[model samples]
Structures are given as structure tokens and as C-alpha cells.
Target: MRPVRVRTVAAAVAGLALLSGCGSAGGLESTGEAPSAVGPARLWPDLPPASAAPYDYGEGETARIPGITVPGDDVHRLDPVTVAQAGLKARTKRDSGLDELPDATVRQIRDCRTAPGDCPVLTPYYFDLTGDGRDELVIGVRLPERQLAVRAYRADEGVLTRIMSTVDAVISVELAGRDLVLRAPSVISGYEYRTAWSWDDRQQAMLATRDEILRVPERRGERTAPTPTAPAPEGSRPAPSETPTA
Candidate 1:
């Protein structure tokens, strides 16, 4: 597989040292003595994944994803979603009612049921996948039939142009540095399917970069899963509370 062309991710942190009250920092530290193992599978945007990729923590205690070189702090700075939303074609369409219970969001879902293209965009995640000093907007929208619409947008000339889009039964959408991850329940017991995307500078778009069907044994009642995960943290909505929360 072609190694992803990018730079050292730690530059963002190192750049922070130049700021006041900030100093040198550390990169991901490996827990094991041996070098990390690499997953063999390679995925592409034009193809469906044959199987899940194996996990390797790499040089860090946490699993280190290869080919994901991004400015850590930059992702937090670019409010890509708001920039995209500002240029949305459907931004003119307004949402009615408030505190009306589940019926509110449910009604919005019904209105856009037949019109999958018109579903309400819930929250968005931002990351500088393009390496152009600008962040891309990864927005997931809620639709009827328990489906989701995930898309990425780039602001060009003060206009948010739709760069990519996909639909699935998604549980969550998240932004992690250069990788935009999504999760959904699977039919297999003790396992859940996850599809992840990374910004490809060459493609000038967000591509399905990683796919994993994980067998997580730590959580209780793996048979049952709950709500989705947001890009902000473990438990939070994707909607920006203040037009861009870092």
C-alpha cells in the first residue's frame, strides 16, 4: 500500500510550546518493548472492505493509526462545520418547534423520510484533512428508518462545496485528528462494525480509509448497544454548542 503522504503529527503540540504557559510535550509512548505490528489490510474509497484490519498500538499505549499525519491543535481551531453550514443549500430551511419531546426530531425525520436528501443535519465534526490550513466538515444527519447520512464539505471561495457523502445505519460519527470515525451495530455477537474515513490530500476528499469489525470483550452485555458516539468526547452531541467548541 502507498504510505500516506503527510508530516509528523507532533508538530501541532511542538508548535504549542511557542505559546505562553506551554512547553515541551510528549508523543504516544509504547507500552510493549517490541515495535508495533501493522495491519495487513488496505482499503480504498472506491472499494468495500473485505475484512476488518487488525489493531496495533504502535509507539503509543493507545492504538496508533498509520498514515494519519495531522496537526492536533489545528483540528480544534478550524470550525469547519459552521463554515460548511453557512454555505449549506438547505440552511435556508428552518426547523420548527422546540422542547416538543422526541416528536420534534421525529417529525423532522418524517418530513425528510421520503427525501433522504432533505434530512436534518444533527451535529458536525471538524478536522484539517486537506493540509491546506483549512478544516473539512464531517457532518452526520439523522434520517428515517434508522439511517444516517454522512458527508464532508470544504469551503471554497467563501462557499461550502459538497465534496463527499454516504448513507448508512450509523450509530455515531467522530473526528480524531486526521481520521473521521463512525460506528454501527453488527449482527455478530460481541462484535460491532466500524467504518472510518481519513482525509486524502491527493484525492482532495474524505475517503473510507479504515474499516474494523471489533470484538470488544471489556464492556458488559456486548449483545446490546446504546446511542451513538460524538466527535467531541465519549458522551456528547455533535452539535456545536457555540458555533465551534474546541
Candidate 2:
């Protein structure tokens, strides 16, 4: 089989820091006086702490992929369609509730080899999200009603382990540094939701470290309608524009 081309985060990081100018230039130079540091103030300190978390973003939720093994510890050698199929199978075995993968999507995965054009499995991208100097497979699967499933897998001891998984009605997925940035439309007008998933070494999983709602510029001659978001299979509703919690 021909080698699959993969993009590396090491290269991306190197390119970004090539001219960062972090090193000293012969001597220490002070541009201006440093500003005074202001520590955070305690507000409502008498209030009792909440018993439970406000939201569950599925952090630290990871699983070892069944019926799949990495060949030569290379993630690129694995078939994207097969990986997606395994994920769907795993979802079915769990109590997914209303967040289950549609039957149509299951059929498409089986037909991907013969009907590549109609396959829901998108072209996979590789990145070193774990900072281990090895590329992990990043894939996106199209679901019904314009929703999408994004997942990432790593080769651990020759076994394929899924490190990150999430579903959303995504507008776009971007690789920013070592974080997987997801952009999705919000129900609120003139605003959009952004979530950034970063690798947590201590947790051994990707966590939603940053979530925000930002105002977007309206386009000319276009009416802004509320875009409804699909519920994630993990039983947590996607954050709306009003809630900026991670």
C-alpha cells in the first residue's frame, strides 16, 4: 500500500516559533515600567459551594477501540471507514438515548468501499495532539440533519484507543496549536459558539478547556435565523450562545 500523507504538529509548532524572538538579544532591554499586578477579589465568599458540576463536557471519557489494531503503530495505516464503523458499533452497545447514530449512517459505512461518493466518512487528518511525536488520526463522520461526529484515535501498545470523541452541528473544525477547535452555530442571533478541546496529560484525554460565545458580523442582505443544534450522544446538550462555560 502507498504511504498516506500526514501533517505533523511538530512541524506546525516549529514553523510558528521560527521567528518568535523569545531569546535575549545580547542584553536585557526594558521597554517600559511593568504594570501593577492586581490579584483576584473574592465575591460572595459566604455562599456555599455547589455540590455538583454545572455541566459535564465528557472530559476524561475515553475508550479502547474494539476490533481494530494499529499496524506498525501507525495510525495512517488504519482505514477511516472501518474506524468509524467501530465507533458506531460501540455507540449502539451503550445507552446513547436520543444521541444514537442514525441507521442511514451505518449503511453508508458498510457501502463506503463500493460507493465512495456517498460515504459519510470524511478524509482523515493526522496530528500530534498528544505531543508524543507520533501522529494521531483525526476523522469526521457526517450524521443526519447536518450533524457531525469528530473523533481522534491513538496507537497505544499496538492497540487503537479513542482519545477524543464528540458530536455537533459543526460549522468548521480547526487545528490550532495542539487544540482541536470546533465552531458551531448558536440559537442566539448574531452570535456563534466555539469550543476548544485540549489534551490533558493528567486525565489522559482531551478536555473542553475553553468554550465561548462571540458575536459575529452579519452579512449583507442575509436574514439571520436561529440555527438549531443537534444534541450530542453523550447525553449532554451542546452549550448555547448564552452559556460560555467550558
Candidate 3:
């Protein structure tokens, strides 16, 4: 699997710095320093125009995994139903109300699978941050400044509400047994990335966050199972059966 790219928060801060500098220039105003002389206005030097590649966020070739070819030029350009199917393929089931989402929103969630798109996958397990019976779906998207867009979705009246959005580089998201676990590297201040996890309850949402840096390890759990008991030490005699009182 490709390493999930996390745009460190430091990168976003750097972008902000560049924009601030440009804004301070105030339309390229000149300082009091003397300006260099220019000859008569001749034809502008034939400098090559800036490349349009960066602006081309158009749909590209479809992504394929060995032995599995998703149908359509943009399987990434799918609707909620398709996304739900993908989740099923991943062995995850969708929350019942997920189908009620607007088609546009569902498509946006599906399209996330490719560059210039966002990938919203439904894991088999649920994360009940609020201790509510209903589990929340974890959605991932790319945001400005090389940051990630992480949100939690809960169904209400057939609509998926965005409980929250935060910065985070999601490394891997999966249904770990019965809980949803999102992993990302640690970020550094002024050179780090942001990552977060969130979930909604009947009344509110809860979120966990981290900042730039990497190689950190942690875990979170929602539901737990009963611990198995060890068998009685091989053939240890049970206390003599209680005798009935006369």
C-alpha cells in the first residue's frame, strides 16, 4: 500500500508566510531605494508562459489494484451507493442512514479516491466517541496548505451532518476488531502536520488531535469485548462438591 501522505502543519505555516509576504508587498510597491533604468519599451522578452499543469486538476486515469479492476473511467467519481459497495468490498458495512445523503455529497465522498479528489471510506467497526449506541463514520479529505481534512459523519433525518473538521495526515484507517483506528505520524511545530479523529453521539461529538512529528504510537478504543478466562489449571480438583446439610 502507498504510504499515506501527510501534509505537515509546518508546510501550511510556510504557505501562510509566503502569502503574508506577498500581501505586505502591496502590489509590488517599490521601496525608497533608487530604481534601475530601463531602455525604450521594446517587445517583452519571449519568456515561456507559466505551465498550466498545476491547474489541471482534471479527472485522470482510473486506479487499479492487481486482479481487481473497478469499472468506469472514474470509479473515484462514484456516488454513496458505490462507496458503500466499496466499503462492503473492504468487508465494512455502512451505517443504515448513509444512503440518505445528497447525491452530490455522496459523489464527493467517493471521488476522494484519486488525486484532486477525496476518499471517504466506511469501516466495518464504529467509533462511539460519545458513548452512544450509534457509531460515526470517519471521513478523510485533502485541505489547503498541504493539510488533511478529517471529519465525522452522523446520520440525522436521512442526512449526514458534518460533526467536525480538522487538520491531520491520515496514515491508515481501519476497523480494528470493533473500533475505528486512524494512524498518522507525529508533526513538529513550524514544520509539522496536523491529524485528528472524531466521532458524534446523540447529543455531541468528540475529537482526538495531534500535531506534526512522526514515529509516535498510540491507540484508541470504543467498544470492548469480555476477556476470555483461562482454563482451570490442568485437572486441578474442584473443591469437593458442597454436601447438603442434614
Each prediction's RMSD over C-alphas, in Å, is 23.7, 18.7, 25.3
> Compared with the true structure, what per-residue lDDT tens digits does model 2 show for residues 53-105?
77665656777778998878899899888888787655422333433467888
Scored against the true structure, residue 148 in model 2 reaches a CA lDDT of 94
Q: After superposition, how far is residue 170 of candidate 3 from its true place, in Å?
A: 3.1
C-alpha-based local distance difference test score of model 2:
0.82
Residue 3 lDDT, candidate 3, scale 0-100: 34
* Model 1 global lDDT (CA atoms, 0 to 1): 0.54
Predictions in order: lDDT: 0.54, 0.82, 0.42
| Residue range 1-246, candidate 3, lDDT tens digits | 233334566677776776666646544345578978988884666876766555421111111112223333222323433434343223112232322334554465566556223444432223554445555555554434444444444443343443443444555654443334555544442232333333323324434433235534334563356999888885795766698667
The lDDT ranking, best first, is 2, 1, 3
Model 2, residue 178: C-alpha shift (Å): 1.3
lDDT of 1 by residue, 113-176 (tens): 4664654766567667666787765666565678776666665544444455556677777667
**Is candidate 2 or 3 superior in lDDT?**
2
Best by TM-score: 2
